[model samples]
Target: MKEMQGELATRALPDLVRDLHAAEATGTLEIEMQGQRRKLHFVRGEIYLPAATPLARRLAALLAEEHSDGHELTALVQRMVDLTSSWREGSYRFLESKDDSGGELVGPLPTLEFARLGGASTSPEAAEAPTESRPSAPPGPPATDPLAKLGGERARWITVPKRSGSFDPAEQWVLEQLRQPRTLRDLLEDSPVPRAELLETAAKLAAAGYLRSLDRPRVETGAFEFQSETLQRLRLRIASFLEEKPLDGDLESQRSRVMELLATREDLDHYQLLGIGPFASTDEVQRAYEEMARLVHPLRAEELGLAESAGALTELFDSMTTAYLTLSDNERRRDYDRQHGLGPEAATVTETSPTAARQEEREELARSYFERAMAYEARAEIHFAIEMLTLATATDPTHAEYFLNLGRLQARNPNWLRRAATSYLRGISLSPREIPPRLELARILEKLGELPRARVQYHTILRIDSTHQVALARRQELEERIAAENRGEGGLLGRFFRKG
Candidate 1:
């Protein structure tokens, strides 16, 4: 079968379809021509049928309506061969719904009426139009693969070119579903747009060649019986609707919402605004902001290792920063508080931007750097600790704990006292209620011989925390020194006057 040529070779359909089914390929199997879409069905290595998707009909209507380019079926078949060379995985990522770009491709396939060579027996006539006015497919069996039941049905198919723009949204959505399979009907029900429009759009997209159905998935029924057989068949058909369609209203609306939500803030701290037990300080906030910005920033999309996902990452960062800034601000924090009926300190809602929701990702990376720096500090490797702390701060400055930790390390190192003081101050600015910063600052002042200032700082600490034993002791010692100095001065003045 692999050894054939011309039309036979150009059409790898029968063999490719069989292999795909054999492997239980889970994603879309798109076949494109110069610009048309073709639908294929497979089940456990069996090539059951070939059909035209609803999207193809929509595309044909569009071509007729716009007087745009029409398609030749043979050329489309050839183009499909050309495309096959690029499929290392032999499948494309699945989409939950048609997108504007994908939908646009479903313009239409040229309907061909064949004329017999001898002018005998059969007469040429236009193909019969469907009885159903709406562009729709029959409800197939409830198998996991939606197209499994429609085998042996010969139907027209079309293909279209890939749309120029970002596929980030489509890619993300597909990946989200890879973790959990969904049906076309489920997709429609979840969409924000009208179901008919969404379906029509998906059909058009399928015709354009951006979407395709999946093969019937193999179900691992118990030891004796295969269960979900029907479900597996239905899933393939459902997969088709998704592959052929652009994103529906729900997906589009959600994407827009994420973008809008992203646009409103600059820092990622709904958690901090809620005051959920104080994991970080101002320094931590700055560190976290920069780190997140690096990951989400449109500019660093390539540099920070999101080259393929540059667009999505950029948009994600934009939303994250916006969210962060909104939550970071006191006034905005209050507004959010009132709206959500939450206190100044509360746990953050899990639902936010998709990008921001990846906290586990951030935390995992964050914890690694934090723990490494702490380990270095524990070993008294001050320089290494400083470097690690610097990286940690850069990655997640919003964590006040990092700043305090860094400052403490600096304070211990003889050569880093000045830097230590700076870090401590930053920590203080972020969290004024913390005692470490206040104590560290007073100690630094005392070390620098700023006795007056040190005493004042100690007094301030006493005011805030009256039971502070260290501050009380320091204040008492400073007072005694002042009294002793006054007595010595008085004695010296009296002796000088007597000698004179």
Candidate 2:
């Protein structure tokens, strides 16, 4: 009834079994030796082995080979005991379950003779003995190695201590799994080693407390802080959807997407509607249609701000569905294309990396959002412009121009100065050699009253481009003011560092 758990190295599994036997405890003794797990069932002090397990079957086979007459089950139990008693490194737990063992048993154990050897080989070479000679568990139920079911490539983990150095092939593979906060799925997928071995080794390491499972974070959304109500509303809803763990749905662009779909739906042919060329490869067309479906999914109407124009949205979606149906079929696609007079160009599969392909797609989509952002900026719809730019940056953060413009727009609002500074920093990181972002960053820093940092930034700009007039003038003026303040004379803005 009391707590029961400890390492076998010190506690000794034999001693623990003797305790359980003395208490007449009815339950299961779970042992984890390195990575291997084995269970012994007890019915009021008498031990029982789960039928058909490797150890059980091995003991049974050995009994027949020995031609033992002294209760075959007795010899087998002793053999199981011998194997377990020989284990010096492992952990153990005793779970009391008199009501039900949750285990199917083959036979009872012999504890009086538990420590006695049944002439069964417990040697290192004996462990490598063939399965036919060993008593294997019964096939009543599937294997209980539930950890092996962590078969997903997306399942991630983190390493503890993040220690390094020499490792066996298995250890090395597991280390790769824990190299970063990446998923075991990715680790297992990328490795050429057998999954069973890798998983088993990982299990052993985990048992030894060498690895830790991670609650991995979602994919990056490019750090968007939406500045408009509509976009913010959509962002929150998409976030909720993601939290609910949908199989797959569009968490990409929303309101503007509906507008784009409505504008082009009627004019573009089926192939064009699907955003594929006449001779587009099958995979390309399929992917394009999937994107279209996500955008026009009727369930997304309210969040996308298309509820008012639901009729148009519905019509566009129908066109998309028709396009997919037609283009997905080779014969139908060919006929539809012929009627449209779109002659086929050789459809060559470029075999581009999926990551590269996705990057290119994002670049194109973000460009559209960027152009729309500029239009909104031109019309003085600062909030709308900010939203579009947010989308552009979130979609493809590699573009320096997106962040530069985003910071500039955000700077127009006094309350957004801090965020503006962050945006400018991101832009500078992406475009270190480009002067525009650094200049804007300097300006934002000044507005935030970070005069010293602003001055430093200006100095950085001058280093990059000595002829730049604005940076030269700003840096010189800041230097003079800072110098004046340090000299105990108040500068233009005010005294800095209390004139000390």
TM-score of each: 0.28, 0.29
- Model 1 residue runs over 4 Å out of place are 1-364, 479-500
Residues 1-500, model 1: lDDT tens digits? 12211221222333333334334442234555334444433332222222244334443544455554334443332333222222222222121222222322342122111111111112112112221321222232344332222211122111111223244444334323322224554443243343334444445444332333332222211112223454344334433543564233433323322332243222323442222222344455555554444333454334434367556654454444444554456666456443432322222223342442244544544465678777766796766666566445544555677778888887776677666655665566567677767788778767765565567667767768999999999989988776666666336775676577
How well does candidate 2 match the true structure in TM-score terms? 0.29
Best candidate, lDDT-wise?
2
**Ten consecutive residues with minimal summed lDDT in candidate 2?**
342-351
Candidate 2 structure quality by residue, lDDT tens digits, 368-463: 778878887889888767877865665566677898889899998999887787667656656777887778777877877767667767776777
Error of 2 at 405 (Å): 0.8
- Cα RMSD to native, each candidate? 27.6, 24.4
lDDT of 2 at 110: 67
